[model samples]
Target: MTPGRLLVTGAAGFIGFHLCRRLLAEGWTVRGIDNLNDYYDPALKRARLSQLEGHPAFTFQHLDIAQRDDLHRLFTGSRFDVVVNLAAQAGVRYSLEHPHSYADSNLLGFVNLLEGCRHQGVDHLLFASSSSVYGANSRLPYSEHDPVDHPVSLYAATKRAGELMAHSYAHLYDIPVTGLRFFTVYGPWGRPDMAYFSFTRKILAGESIPVFNHGQMQRDFTYIDDIVEAVVRLVDHPPQRQVDWPADPATSAAPFRIYNIGNHQPVALLDFIATLEECLGRKAQLELLPMQAGDVLATYAEVNDLAALVDFAPRTPLARGLAEFVRWYRQYYGTA
Candidate 1:
């Protein structure tokens, strides 16, 4: 299937930048937009954009989706076959302090994007939801069928809200929508705030790394390559209206679907650190700490729905993924 034009929000961020590059490589004209805020390092975001800037099929825009007028203009001015939204005010703990940012980006910005799709009529609208929405579920392997009513963090709440909003749009306007519940996606050129990225840096700098929950936590640590592969395969497959649906929350009588994309293999925090140490050839000084606010004990995703839908399964092992990240980190930071 050939795509006409595509618009990717948060195009300079970790996932967005990677997705844009892949789209361009597959001959899709991608219009990439980002606020490039100093949530982490704007320089890193710019660096990611630099690689895509040289590509003939890529176009960059310095814009924020929270700005309704700007976003409206972009959607009206351009025709997009698919709109892959990867932009949001990320970070669970950070949302505790800067609550307004989450409201603006994840809540308001999300509504704006949904409105755009509703008006313009895109073939498929895919947005990045998070596994964090499974807050307080206590389930071992979180499923899309599991209810996500209790989100401890504002970030998670906002994501859950986005899903609801998307469902409404999908039903009202008949726009095809897919919500991806990504589980701890990490790899080369990942976000600095992520534990793996920060751990690698602190370990290389000979500093003690913070281990939350006294290293008792487990994560379905998915790799970026696997994440990208699932998304690329899903772009062509839009969900149809299921009138005979047996009250499944994941899909309904509307053109809406949700899938959990993860490695489905939860790794212990302690063992994850050990792998990183081996990859860097240096052990980390551990600062074991109690569980922080808005932090969950574990996140093990049941990617069965994703596997069945797109024939996708995240196969990247933590050690292998961390090794790749370590290699990129050393080269990117001149640590080696």
Candidate 2:
């Protein structure tokens, strides 16, 4: 049995595209929206949309979430049971280059989603946050309990800001909201701007791939399938306002909650690269570089809370995931 209608922002994006397909397969009616901006390649966005276009249960809308009037009209026109917001100007390094883009999408656009949900009386609002919010906190396996006061980049700051902003709306308007702190999501049809994707491209072209932080950094890279599964399960379980909620940042008196969705297994950069090399049957020309600004040395997620709730965690092995990605890359690029 399928649920009611869903409005997925950034539907043409990597995660969003996968999520829409999942919902549609489960027999849910989904309306997907994407501005299709030239953040990377609009052609990729179109390709994602092409898959969904054939599905009768899926509809695609072309618009920016930051556009106030359009967003309002969208909410006014449809009675969406859930709104999964995955749209934003992504890339931590790119955030330094264009700070205002973060303001436009992460900040301004986030508010628009909040307003739309508040007015539309949405049942649940699930939005994308990031592991980067761990920022200056030197904690391993970052938990929602940790204080994220210091953000290293404009991108991290804006994501943290979005969480705070969502809490306010959840408190005042009583909107049921869940902020998911995603830890380095990667898989087939993933974003080209991401390190793994770009590295694969450069490696195939026989060019030097930038090995940042001297290839010392580690990440808990979660597969897209695991991410989609967890989110789909969580949709039916919106947080209820707790009578005895703690003052801790993890929970609230409002109908709001946050969870870290990750594989929880941190893989070293060099090991990851080696696995990729095996998958592609080619060695990458390495350019060892110092850690870029606004970049963290490591990311590990503590998904105990999510496990307690859903009895599930991302369990995909890094090597297996990389192999799948490499397979898709070759097929998609017609190099296989």
Candidate 3:
């Protein structure tokens, strides 16, 4: 009872892992590919893969998208209906340290994906963009309609580059494409590099946690389930070129669109830490620090277009999501 075969790059990643599980549950034949790079912990990535190993409709492939030959071979053999490109070297500070990595994976790898989708004639291609693309904007809630010309970080620049790249392919090849601008996504089985996850670990170990920007930061923290729900809904609703397509950067005459998938609520850094403390039943020792390079003061998403299109929006409260994450953290680490 499978709907169609779909290819999800970075299938072992945090968001990709959750998306793969959801797609498999819905009885879709999923071809999950990942390079399994040691970006954080390969062990954690393998653990996620272990959960999907026995699924009847899931197949795992170990290959780097940056490797042109392997990627071409994959697209030549498999006739996929949709391709979700979530594979990228993620992290703002890390991007500063590893600019070449971002160029290799986020830039070159994405071109390979576009080429694959073009040749394979993929019905739709959904990719993971970042809210960080709204760089240097003083606006309260970032919107798709806003201009995203200035990117403060290499990571954000690459993500914005991906959007432009995808738009070009859609215009040239008429491939239907959607770019999701995810904001501060967090939940169970999340990346350890994320502040919440690392903060939990440090708090449990009675260590000091670094509070950046003098604890003035805010984020539109979206739950993993909410993200999965939004993505699932949009999969059935590929972007169609509008009859009266304006000369706008947000959309195009091509079948391409971008949506900010996030909880519109922006929580302050101190309040978020308080919620985490309540969840873990422990207070954190904070070391206030200046804002790091390639860091933003806040991120709030304007999801009106997403709501209008999907008839849904992310509604998970921060307290509940943090509680769930804490529960999983303690159990996963045997610290409960």
lDDT of 2 at 80: 95
* lDDT, residue 160, candidate 1: 97
What lDDT does model 2 reach?
0.93
- lDDT, candidate 1, at 251: 82
> TM-score for all predictions?
0.99, 0.99, 0.98
Cα distance off (Å), candidate 2, residue 265: 0.4
lDDT of 2 at 216: 95
Residue-level lDDT tens digits of model 3 in 76-176: 98899988999999999999888999999999999999999998888889999999999998888898998999999999999999999999999999999
Clashing pairs in 1: none
lDDT tens digits, residue span 1-336, model 2: 248899999999999999999999888999999999999999999998999999998989998999999999999888999999999999999998899999999999999999999998999999999999999889898999988999999999999999999999999999999999999999999999999999999999999999998999999999999999999988988989999987878889999999999999999999999999999899989999999999999999999999999887787898899999999999888875
Q: Arrange candidates, best lDDT first.
A: 2, 3, 1
Scored by CA lDDT, what does every candidate get? 0.93, 0.93, 0.93
Q: How well is each residue in 24-53 modelled by candidate 1, as lDDT tens digits?
A: 888899999999999999999999999999
lDDT value for model 3 = 0.93
Model 2 residue 264 lDDT score: 91
